[model samples]
Target: MRTYLAARAACIVFLFSGSAAAAVSEEEFAQLRAEMLRLAERVGVLEEENRELRQVAEATVSEVQLARTEAQEAGRTVEEWAPGTTFSGDFRYRYEEIDVESRDIRSRHRLRARFGAVARLSNDVEIGLRLAAGSESPVSGNTTLGSGGTSKDLYLDQAYAKWRPFNGAYVTAGKMKNNFYRPGGAGLAWDSDYTPEGLAFGWSGEQLFINAAAIGLESDSRRDNHTFYYGLQGGARLPVGDTVSITAGAAYFDVPVQGESSFFGDADDFFGNSFNCTDADNCAYLLDYEELELFAELTYSGFAMPLNFYADYIRNLDADTYDTGWLAGARLGKASAAGSWQVGYQYEDVEADSVLALLRDSNVGGGGSDIQGHKLFGSYAVARDWTVGFTVFVDNDAGENRTGSGTDYDRVVFDTIFKY
Candidate 1:
């Protein structure tokens, strides 16, 4: 446009200056007009190029804005779906052998895998879900190896929500982790893998802790009564010396089972609890369980490796006889680092009707009551998050009713475990 205006101004000046126009020849005038035409053509071309450049710049800006908007939307969607989520998993492989008094020694290979996710919904609330390799057994999670290479089952191991209303106080509901204390991991009353379905409450102070739970035992709409288990425990830790500490606690459990009814749809599931069977489907518990437990642990950290001595005792107040169970053990060191190792030895005597047979340690005394045994276990961490362990159980029947009565029972387990 500037060149076009300049060309027009030159023509106007030539036309107004009559002397200058007359002095120029016709040929010169024609050449001047041709030059002016060329300048006009150049201006038109330049304007077209500028128009294309403007359009290209606008399109590039539009694409950048669109990409920015899409990226922000994606971030918001991710936040809604995955707020503070974390994943955890562990796997264990085992070789086990069980020998009874007169029966053939049984050997098997087993594997257990567990995967879980926990998400934080808020500062005060969180939820967890876990899947495990196992059947519907409440006390065991091992999947036996082999059956024509059949696919294994995956059970819902945990589905729970936890809410912490304040510091050191929390509530949990659903199929949740056990909140009750087990001194030195003793399985006299509860198994490690037994996740209960119900509600649990806990409070912890600097030197004291308390736990309570209301668990659902059996629920049947057709029956008039449903069974439930309630538990409460409180404990305190006291320092006796410079490197010595003692922890002591007491617990109470009430289990009221309806008579003349089968639990878990199988009378054989009693696992040595005193019961009378009327038929294959109808059985009655001999006694209701009102249990009182006293537990204590003493730890001395004066040595290079800490020494822990613990004892657990439970008595069923409702039963007349065979209603007591006890365990005493000592552990040295801890298998927490790559080069660390630990060894433990415990002696257990569990009589029939002492505790619920179905909930006690499954591997000890081959799964439940009427058993007295010694358990020795050791573990070594070869690397971080990886460990190998061995456990041996030497047990015998305390009563004549269980299989292979008055005979020796032994079980050996070798395990390799990995965690992430």
Candidate 2:
């Protein structure tokens, strides 16, 4: 439009002027029109480029938004479980050999499997359940290979509720795992499989720890026949320096029972054909022993591997006969981290009626109180949360005066375990 207006003005000036000095030549008008055409063409090209750029920017934003949505959907798929609810368990395969003195030594293959889940409501309260592969036995969770059983059997190993009402304090009840402290990794006083049915509590400070519990061992149909077990333990952990620490504790257990219907029954079969009680039905009574135990452990980390030296002593406070037992051991390393290894050896001398037979180490001398043994064990963590382990027991039945078995009874166990 500007070009047309300028041309009209130029024609008017040429038509009305008497002098031709200001008149525009035809050639000049033609040049001006060509220049205007070139300018308009450039503007049109710039406008088209701007439009294409806007479309590209919109498409890039849409693609980015789509990617973000897909990422959020994938995250939701993995966030299915509620917070504080976790699942974990382990499975073990074992081959065991039981060597007896002056008798036929037997060997067997066994297996153990466990699955557990825990749900936490808050920092103070949680509930857990566990399913284990075994019949209800205090000491043994092993399933014998080729038992000809039609179906696999599983038992509730642990069903418990735990609460921490305050700092450094806890309460647990139901058929829960043993809450008592084990001095040297659990073989001395209680079997690994022995989950106690009771209510237990613990309170701790910076260095001092206290524990107490009351457990129902056997419940009779008749009211008075009910049996109970009670325990109280206290301890302290003291660090000497950067490399040395000591842990010591004293514990007392009161078991009040005497009858054919003993604590959990002799199905544990700790006693052979000759049991202390003269009952006809497979020695059904459990020998009542009130135990008082003191234990101390010393750990030194100034070596290639951490070293722990431990000693545990127990006396049956109520026994009129044999009344004392002790165990000493040392272990190198914990064998917990991947590719780490551990080895340990323990010597145990337990007198008859010195400790409760129903709950002690089942693999050593058949879980009897009248036994002495040397236990050697080694373990290696092969992969993450997996381990291969071996244990050996060279024990003898030592009744009062060591007259029960002059011969040796040995046992060996090899196992591989995987945990998650």
Candidate 3:
């Protein structure tokens, strides 16, 4: 543009100089100069508009690239999903103390960690798996806090599939988490750590629930006998008023055996140095049982905090003797969220055959049946997904008068737990 302007100036100078001999008109020179200025201004405006168009084009290209990259990332995520899935679990550090009637005293520190995941095959079907830091301890999933040089044991705690073919119905199979609700979250009927392997069906509605399961408890190859556990439970939940609600359930469980039912909570042969039934070492036993358990819970929300009162009763119709168990408690607060505090107290009288000795709450007289105790517990959520809790059990054998009855005991547990 500058060179063109300079050439134009030179031409005007030459024209004027030449025109001097012809005595040229001044108006023609002025008109030519004005036309040059207008042309330069138009070119400048066009150049600026062209630059803006280039910038707009570049921006559009950038947006296209970003969209392509996001699409690729979304494809990768879907390809990795087996349908779709979520993962969750918790960990806890526990300190325990057990003193038996001024005689036997024991203390231990333990760690319990478990992780699980669920993958949806569709809205109607899903698979779940839980892995834990312990062996096959059916009633306690804790690993002792020591033995550093030794390899830790990790077990498949649960591997199951749940299917919902219709509204308010679920069918589950394999070793699965308990589907029954215990009044006041009591551990009397089913231990906290017990996961039964079997087939189960459950249904829930606005005010009613039903659950049933058939569990394979044990197998005997020599005698070709099997122990099967069957259970059915139905319950109703009702609101009494604007500030109160009540829930109740009736349950029946039958654990029948061909002969001696020995597999309830007996230590595994590998750990307890006892021969399994399959072993040739002459190990055989039996337990025959059927239980009718009733449970109830009442909540009053009108208090400063919610107050929950709960009770459970169970009787073994097939036990030879001492076959009754019941518990009652009241809890204040849910203790589920951060900054929440909760306290609860319960008293239980459990006979030897009332509930399966091996599957009852381990904290009650060291997880054995034929025990009576007051369990007091409290918890505080110190942070999100973390809590500190303590539980005290003042327990004694219900059948202490009988020969070979277990001794009396008091147990305390302090734990710091984490969940995510």
Model 2: residues with Cα > 4 Å off, grouped in runs: 1-79, 220-225, 265-279, 282-287, 398-403
Worst 10 residues of 2 by lDDT: 266-275
- Model 1 over residues 1-420: C-alpha lDDT tens digits? 677668676875674476766978878776776786676677779889988999999999999999998898777744466768888899999999999888999999999999999999898899999999986889898999999999999999999999999999999999988888888988989999999999999999889999999998775556644777899999999999799999999999999863735455476467778887777766788788899999999999999989999999999999888889999999999998898999999998888888888788887778778888899999999998999999999764545544455557899999999999
The most accurate candidate by lDDT is: 1
Candidate 2 lDDT tens digits, 1-420: 456546655754554465543455767655655665676666567768878999999999999999998887778632264677888889999998888777788988878899988898888999999999876777778887785755668999999999998999999999898888888775666777889987999999999999999988764457544777899999999999999999999999987654434445544354321234454444444456688999999999999899999999988777666678889999999878898999999998877667777788877776767778788999999987999999998764544334743457888989999998
lDDT of candidate 2? 0.79
Model 2 TM-score on a 0 to 1 scale: 0.77
The list of candidate 3 runs beyond 4 A from truth reads 1-83, 102-104, 219-225, 264-287, 398-401, 404-406
Candidate 3, residue 372: Cα displacement in angstroms equals 0.7
**Residue 65 displacement in candidate 1 (angstroms):** 12
RMSD of 3: 8.5
Relative to the unseen true structure, what is the C-alpha lDDT of residue 207 in candidate 1, on a scale of 0 to 100? 93
In candidate 1, which residue pairs get closer than 3 Å at backbone N, Cα or C atoms, i.e. clash? none
Write down the TM-score for model 1.
0.81
